[model samples]
Target: MDAGQIVEPPRILARRSGDGWVLYMDGVEPSYVRRLDGAIERGRVLMEAGKVPGVEHGAVLKIDLGDELNQRVKTSTQATADAHKAQVAAAAELRRTAAALNEHGLTGRDIAHVLGVSPQRVSQLLNDQHARG
Candidate 1:
């Protein structure tokens, strides 16, 4: 995230960085969302499903540029989440491929070599797969 880049606001709570004024939204996933329609949709769905205890429609305190959370913090959180999600997915796929190679009579070392990863990484991948179950 670069300086001056606008980010998607939090769905729950926010405080204006410039004025220190707090803004809140009421609902309960789209709970506290910036989008009124999203909140209403979630509430309606929950109510229809009898999942929510109660529902509120289209309530908002204020919706600013979403300067509530520190920009750096928001950037870091989003970046970390994105990186971890990608890593989890990629690691799972790599392990699946590695297992397939192993089933084809490839040694762990052989799989590692073909996959351009460390032999230890092959073990890690296998361990991760076992852990998943």
Candidate 2:
């Protein structure tokens, strides 16, 4: 086989050996085909050889598994972005609600009790313009 040239109908053949299985291709031993006693073994043999038995010229390139590192990085980035956005939104809502409660003659402690947050948090939200307000 020439380098960089893809083999077509890459042949894989399997045969039973002593208490196990042996896999081969073009009379070359590739690997040991294990646990072959039924249809599962047959499927494994066929898949490894890049061919579907009983089907003429049936071959397909193996599926490309995605890069684990790339997937993890993308997931991490999206999660961080979503968390930041949620934090900003929650802070803005807290400030708005605090202002409304203040208009109704509610103290920071009362607003905290109604909103289920700490009184210090309510004070921070009301006093600090940069605290998501």
Model 2, C-alpha of 16: deviation from truth (Å): 39
Clashes of each: 3, 0
Q: How does model 1 score by TM-score? A: 0.43
In candidate 1, which residue ranges exceed 4 Å CA deviation?
A: 1-76, 131-133
- Cα misplacement distance, residue 18 of candidate 2 (Å): 36
Candidate 2 lDDT, 1-133, residue by residue in tens: 4667654654444455666555554423445545534323444455655544332434322211246855886899899999999999987887888888987999889999999999998888788644544
lDDT of each: 0.61, 0.62
Q: Name the top lDDT candidate.
A: 2
True-structure RMSD for candidate 2: 14.4
Error of 1 at 10 (Å): 17
**Leading candidate by TM-score:** 2
lDDT of 1: 0.61
lDDT of 1 by residue, 5-45 (tens): 65543233444444343334343332333443354354455
